[model samples]
Target: MNMQRSMLAVLLASTIAMPAISAEQGGINAEQGITTAIPMPVANNAEADAQLSAEELAKQQAAEQAQKQLEAIIGASGLEGLGEQARNLAQQVLNETQAPLGFQYDVVDRLTPLWAPVALQNTLASALASLDDQQRELLQSTLNSRRLQNARSKELSAIADQDNRNYQDYISRLRQQPPAPARVALIKQLDEAMQFSALLSVTRSSVYPQLQAVLRNWQPPQDWQAGLQRDVTEFLLYVHRTTPNDELQRLAQAYREPVLQQWLAGVKKSLSRQAG
Candidate 1:
């Protein structure tokens, strides 16, 4: 019976091995067929290579044509004329689209009221003084838009040189004073003004250095370390926001006392924690 069982196991092993051997032989035959069949692809590959070459040549020709056209346009019309033509084409395309009602008309009407005559005359003179009739007409057409005229007027009206100088002088006087509550209040008022560019100029010219000096001489009160930390952090952030990064680094280096450094480190750690 043991010999019979051993024979049965051998029979089972042979059954599995026979299939594996047959599969291996079949795979080898399949591989040989694939290798023989691959040569058939060479014709297709040559056809594809020829097609790709034709496509590349077509693209190259198209690009050359486009470049030549651009050069011809530049030579004949000039860059400014080309730009004006492009703009007019774009506007025509935009006008044909049914996107919204009255939007373009509203924009044009809004701009017409603001046009400055003197500035427009000056601009036209500057643009057309050296040009021929055709070029002058082109420039006039470009600048003749009601919107352009209005924009020039608005720009001229917005700044009075005398008033601007006076305001800067006032700000300088305020900055020279001690950093009392009044000065801080004045700074806040200036900051709230709509003319932020002018305000910024005055702040950089006047207020910033004064604030820095105040910070340098500041003596923190007892039990005021926390408040000092907060103030310094706020001040640094203010500086960072108002001053450029290079200027901020210089200011930071100037204020790198032990207390200020400690405050800055705390601020950095707090920021990192918030970010995380």
Candidate 2:
């Protein structure tokens, strides 16, 4: 797939925030996958680890904390229980439905700087992590409760997934058929809750310099940023297509809690610094 077509896939089954559960919940968490499954594993550089500059170390710590924050949000969001009920049902839903998105990992691996997603993921996590314990619990409870309330909605999360295939074929048509102004407003709120543009900008900033460091001959396409932004907006729109307006409003507002915004700003500052 071409890069633009695959921009939607960077979401990696997490249109919300890719919020993996943190270690406090358990050792077996998705955070492990982020560090391990990255296209270029930074964990492999043992020798380089020791020599990190203070600035690099700070960024690393910020990234780690952000990751923990993300995991915290994801883990708490699960229904409280030791049994399968506690096993992040939302994550399961995403994993199952992501297949239709054309998960273009190859494209993500090739063009974007290796650290970009790592940074982005952690930035999102940090924003999520910023919420206080009570707020976090509220966020978790709200999601599960709303979802259960509308259990009547057939595959509520899966509706958008079905319409996600034929990436190229759908983009033009999708753009032409713009969402209603109300939907657009909600989407903008959703982006704010998630710190979508801020984190996106943060990653976009480092991409070129980092790429130059590793791939001297590499040059990014001019339209790459615009394309990715469009995909992100559309992907989120698709996910929420079947969600009830009231529930969707609450969901977006949950993340916009003052605490999340505060954390979002902190991570943005930290991630703005280069890892190297």
Candidate 3:
């Protein structure tokens, strides 16, 4: 009975050990399969990432190259100089007897000194001159208008300078005045004009309309009547010099006082006559 019990115990131990060994073998097979599959997926992902990075880098380099080329062109040939050349070309065209042909050849010859690469200069001249008769006329008209406008601007600048000196003199006198309300108002007006003039000289035409809007709705500081007259005078002078007739008329209409409105109308008429 004792021998049979010992043998049964040994049999149970072998059965348990067999299952443990089988489980170990199964685990080793699973680990090997995972290790082999992992590298292929990882390598594919790395290759895809590298390709995408290369494409993005290429796009960035292309954009930078385009920007550099544009800068080079603009630096070598300035817009203002080109505009002057166009103006000169238009004048030459006007003086030529031949309707179009002589003017075209003359422009090409004149611009050769200004633009490098004689071929490019000639090409541009021919392209510009190839416009239809109506387009040519329109270009001529615009050029003529610009020339006249530049002349008028010089004249207006001289007038404005003289007026500014007079305004400064007025301010000096007002400072010596006996504390009058009108004198105070005039000082304020002069200050506003000075500020507006600086803006007009530097800012673009598109922004000038917005300035007029603000000026139209502006109100004088309260209890400062004596210091505001100069300010009003300066503001009006600036508007007369810079603002168009249509805008000035609109401003005149917006003012409640009939006298101020009439004054603004007179200013518009004066500007028109001067421009003409």
lDDT of each: 0.32, 0.49, 0.35
Worst 10 residues of 3 by lDDT: 16-25
Q: Evaluate model 3: give its TM-score.
A: 0.20
Per-candidate TM-score against the hidden true structure: 0.17, 0.46, 0.20
By descending TM-score, how would the candidates be arranged?
2, 3, 1
lDDT of 3 by residue, 1-276 (tens): 001112112212221111110111111123557344655577876787788677767766755653443333222222222223233323332333233444334433443332223222222233333344454344334323443334335334543554467656654654465344554344334334223222222211222222223334432234433333344344344324444445444333333233222322333333233223
lDDT of 2 by residue, 137-201 (tens): 56545544554335313223433344556544455666888878888778777767766665665
lDDT of 1 at 37: 60
Q: What is the lDDT of residue 239 in candidate 3?
A: 29
What clash count goes with each model? 4, 3, 21
| Candidate 1 residue spans exceeding 4 A from truth | 1-38, 80-276
Per-residue alpha-carbon lDDT of candidate 1 for residues 1-276, written as tens digits (9 for 90 to 100): 001112112212221110110111111122457344655577886887788677767766755653443233222222122112222322332344432334434322322221122222222223223444454344344334453344334323332321466534543553465344543443333222212222123212232232223234422234533443333233223322333445434333333333323322332233233223
